[model samples]
Structures are given as C-alpha cells and as structure tokens.
Target: MNYRIILALGAFVPAAAIAQDQPAETRDKTSAVISVGVDYEEGSYGTDQDIRSWSVPATVKVQHDRLTFAASVPWRWIEAEGKGTIVTPDGPLGLPLFPSETQVDQRIVREGLGDVTLAAAYALPVKVVNLSVSGTVKLPTADEGLGTGETDYAVGADISKTIGAGITPFAGLTYTMPGSSEGYERKDGVAVNAGVAAQIGKRATGFVAYQDSASTSDGLPDGQRVATGVNVGLGGGVSLGAYGSAGLSAGAPDLATGLRLGFLIP
Candidate 1:
C-alpha cells in the first residue's frame, strides 16, 4: 500500500496555510516544526487476501522566507496473509496441497524502517490567493522484501484562496516518476486532490478533503479516498491533530487513522 504517499499529503494539508499566505509582518523570517505521529491502515486486495500495517513517523520542517524543507522517517510493522492459486508447468494446482481443491495460504510478518522522504516547497503569496510548488524524493530504507527498494520522485503544485472569515479552499495536482528494483516493475502516475479548511475557534481548525490517484502499474486499480480532520493549538507553540480516512476504491486501504503532536520554534 502507498502509506508514505498518504502521510506526505497529510503533512502538507494543515500546514499549507502557515507556509503560504500569512501577512509579511506577522510571518517569522525563519521557523521550524517537529512532529511525531502514528498511522494504522488495513487493505483488502481480494477475498481471503488482506494486509495490515502500523507505522510511527517523525518529521522535521524548516522554513525561510518563501522556501521550506522537510523530511520524514517512519518505523513500520506489516502483516499480511493471502490464499491464492499458482500455475505450474504440469497444470493449474491448488495451494496448501490439501486433499480437496483449495488455495494455498501464505503469511508474512515484518518490521523495519520504512522509506525516508525529503521534500522542498516554495510559495508565492498574493493579496487574495497563494500558489505553491513542491518536489519530493523517497529513499529506500526498509528491508528489501518489505519496501519498494527503489527511489521515487514527485512534483506538485497547489493553489489556494482564502475567503469569508478564515475559510480556505485549495486544490492540487501531482505527477510521480516511479522507480523499479530487481524483480519489480514500477509505473508513473498522477494524483489530484482538493479540500477546504475552516477556522472553528480561536485555536482550532477543521478540514475535509478528497483525493484520487491513477493506477501506477498494470493490473492495479485506481484509488480514491476521503478524509476529515482537525488541528487544535495548545499553549506554548504546541499543537495536536487527528484524522481518519476511508477508501472509495478497491486499490485503496479500507480504513486509515492517524494522530500527531507537533511543536514549532521561531
């Protein structure tokens, strides 16, 4: 599953405003943020085939003027089981070597470092609207069998407008270049997402978003998801956030939940 992609998108959503359109005088010349979070997800690929994973991710971001740099690293545990049929030279064979015809059951459990991600963004602020562009790189860091073991690259652009009392509506589009490792074939793809954020109280904001991505490989289905979340500011430059998402397509995870705690420094 594309857990890293989801995390990257989540990181950008709430912080988009802070990095984009604040008034010049109120903005800090240099600032940094550190965050730690956890994510859980389950995916069902077919009947009797399913996978579950849990991840703990930590991120650091630094901003100067209109440019921002960020990185994230995660530790992940994954468990998967499936029953399938395999074809042999002799003929189609049932798995598990059962007396009766039945599919074979295979299972795996692994835990290790997930992929590491590095990213940069630049924003152009205007009176009523903001435009930003970003690029990201993914490094293979996990065990070979547990990770893609390939470097990935992506670039995206976002446009947002704030209107009517702290309500911001934003849209973004991204294109990714996939990489391949031994025994693997990767394909390029595109993603689009849109959302709106609204101030709920003096120190809280809420948002809802939708995202869709084209299939990145042959035989894979396109994916879609919807998410809702809130960020609450605590005293002393600390904040808390929670979010949940549901899949709208066969290729997406059935459910995902996440929580984050963050600190900012000026």
Candidate 2:
C-alpha cells in the first residue's frame, strides 16, 4: 500500500467505528387531526310530531403509534315542540319531559352547547384481522333543555378484516352505562354497527353501514338505521366526507344528513 493512502485509511477506519458505536435519538411519532362538521336529523324520536335537530360539531384527535385519543363537542339546535328525548350521535344525553297535553301556543325551540365527549382507543397490530378497544366519557355541559345534565360512560370493541385493493369489512359493539334523571331512571344499552368500505380510485372512498342500539328506557323502542357515505381526499392533508341515513325503526330518525371536513397534521 502507498504510505499516504495507508495513513488516510488508518485514520478513516477508527472514525467510522466510533460513529457506529453511537446512535442518534429516535423522534417521537405523534400526529393530530382536527375535524368540523354540520349534521341534521329529523324524526318524532318517539314523540307525537316530527322533530328536527341540527348540530355543528368540532373534534380533535391525536394518535401515537397504536393508541388514539379524541375530544368532541357540538352546538345544537332542536325543534322540540314535540320531542320527549334525544339520542344524539354522541349517544343518548337528553331526557326532557314535556306535558303531552300542553297547549301548542306555548312551544319554544331549544338551542345551546351539547354534551362534551372524550375517548381513547388502542389497536393491536395483528395480521388477517385488525382489533381495537375503546372507552368514552360524556360530560354534562348543556342546559336541561338539551341534555340530561349527567355524566355517562361506555366501553367498546371493533374488529375489521382487510381484503384486496382497499376493501375492508368492519364491525363494532358498544355498551353504555347511563346516569339517572328525575322520574326517568335510565338503563344500560347496547349498540352495534357493521359496514364495508371500498376505496374508489386514489382520492375517494365509499361505504355503507348499518347501526342498531337497544333502548335505554321504557316507552322508547330499539333504534335501527342504515347509512351510506363517501370520503374524498382533497390533497394537502385535507379531506371531506358526506353521508345520508334512513331510519329502519321508529326509534331512530326518519332522515339524517351530515358532512365532515378534516385536516391532518404531522
């Protein structure tokens, strides 16, 4: 070997070995997503006349590896001239009592901030099937006209199977334990949802789902609903989703529609 080349090689090899002995710290892999949307629902909700409801909701979700956390709240407007109780998308929160024989001239609309909800979920990394478990808490933050003014809790599990080309079948089940209200003691309820989602092209996807929930109180029937929706990617980490639903039973809304816009942050 040439003398100068050997000297250069000797110096370089020790530096390379020293560099291999130390490793840089790994970065934290946490991400967040925010979403806002408006929803409208109409039905009797087991009342004498059709009641229309609307809500504007905002949510923040965070994820780190397989764990996820989220918080959501909504501003609600309810046409409650004939509504007795309201079971929101956040689950049952209100059990308002109105005299059935009250004069129609005395009716008034109810509007305010609805209940605030928090949730956490964890997924297990597995092949063939994906599985996750979650828990949720509902805080009483609304006036008595809009909510039961009580806290509630739920635990749930979700399972999904992914097939070829972005088609997946999924199902979830939740059990809720509700708090009591004056003259109307609530009971635990069970909810289940199943669906198939298909990826259409690169920027859009579609899904159809069925949902059902057991009644949490007397005089209220079981809720059944079917829905279809589409989600489209708008580039730059933004997306939009729209959905429509129909009630399969009297316990659910006769018709409902909603849209959500979401942004992903790294």
Candidate 3:
C-alpha cells in the first residue's frame, strides 16, 4: 500500500464531522486581546522505545468580542537509540539501527516551523455565558518525513460554551490536505479536535484537549493525540503558560510530547 493514501485519510475526515452542525453568529468588536504561550516537553518516543525527544511550541491569539483568531509555531529536536526494521521490495529488511538506535549517536536533529495554523472564530451571545464557532487552515511549512507529518491545510469549525464558573468546553474539526510535493506524500483527510478550559481563581487558567486525525486518508496509521497545560496572569497585564501531550497509539513513532512557556500582554 502507498503511504500517501494513508496520509490523506489520517489528515482530513474528523474536521468534516465536527464542522457540519455549527451555527453562525455576529462578529465581536469588543476589545482586542493578545496572548502568548510557550510549552516544553520531553519523553521517550514510545512505551519502552529507544527514541527520546523534546520540543518547544509557542502560540499567540488575538480576540475582540465576536471576532477571535490564533496561530502556533513549534520548534523541535529529537534524539533516539533503538533498532528499527525497514521494509524493502525484495522483502522485510531489518536494519539494526534503522529508526533510532544509530540516530542517537549522530544526534539526529530536526527543527523548524513545525506547522503554521490560522483560525478565526465568531461569538454568539448565549443567555448566561457565550458560544463561539471557529475555522482553521494548516499550512505545510515543515518537512513531513524529517520532522512531523503535518498536512497542507485543513478547514473546520469549533464551538466554545462557557458556564457560570469560568469553565468552558470546546470541540471542533477540520478537513486537511496532504502535501503533493513529489516524494513528500501525505494522506489528505479529516481531523477532529476537542477540549475543555477553565479559569482558576483570578490569575490562572487551565485547559485539556485532544485531536484525532484519522479519516483524512487510508495510507497512514491512525493518529490520536492529547494536550493539557496551564497559564497564569502576571501583574501589569502580562501572562505565562506551559503544556504537553503524548500519542497513545498509532505506530508512526514511539511518543511525541511538547511544552511551552511565555508571556503575553493584554
């Protein structure tokens, strides 16, 4: 089977599913708010796999009343030490150091603008709290094979509902397009995203979210991921944040985690 097919399915489906039932709303012109956050993560690529890695992802968001937007760019470096088998036309070939084993010695390093995502959201005035819907597109800025297998673009919608206690639950999905740049084949598919967030007291906030990239294409294995982190409000309108996530299944790699810490001014 071809990896491109897998990449397409794994990348596009879930976004389609989540965006189908969203309601439109008026744009907000309240106050323009800005936030910046950074995260750092480190762990073995998978279960007991010999590969280990770390990353620093930074994100920024701007929001007014009915209108909101966000962007994130992550820089990563990986080092591993494990044996992996690579298949060939003749048969299954086992390379003692195919995957991570030999890479660690040479300090295989991959770093760049992992992926650039841009999103816009509209807020709907509900009774007590508020509800918002959003859409995003992912750009293929990183090397899929050498770095992370990020697709070309995705379109989807998100819903954010707030409760009495400053707690909100958000869910969304997007359609992704795999890059068709020659050897860099990726499955174009739908990806689903969901999460919850809350304000802790007066100076802190926390959130947890998950992304399932399955339906986009059939060429690659299933991609399931989760993320969680916290942010704190500093005096003089400044803030800091950090978060991380790991892949549960999807034999693509052992494990991939991330962390971020940064400051934002309101």
Give me candidate 1's TM-score against the actual structure.
0.84
Q: Quantify how close model 2 is to the true structure by its C-alpha RMSD in Å.
A: 15.8
Give the per-residue lDDT digits (tens) of candidate 1, residues 1-266. Answer: 11122234353232222234445774558888898998887776323557777878898988888888888877877766665521100000000110113567777666777677787878766555678788877777665444556777777787777778878787787787767655445577777878887878788878788877776655456668888887878989898888888889876667888888989897
Best by TM-score: 1
**Residues 24-62 of candidate 3: C-alpha lDDT, one tens digit per residue:** 342222323343323233333222334443434455655
* TM-scores of the models, in the order given: 0.84, 0.83, 0.60
Q: What is the C-alpha RMSD of each candidate to the true structure, in Å?
A: 7.7, 15.8, 9.6
Instruction: Give all candidates' CA lDDT scores.
Output: 0.64, 0.64, 0.43
In candidate 2, which residue pairs get closer than 3 Å at backbone N, Cα or C atoms, i.e. clash? none
What's the true lDDT of residue 42 in model 1? 79
Give residue 205's lDDT in candidate 2 (0 to 100): 76
The runs of at least 3 residues in candidate 3 whose Cα sits more than 4 Å from the true structure, single-residue gaps closed, are: 1-51, 58-60, 80-107, 112-117, 124-151, 215-219, 251-259
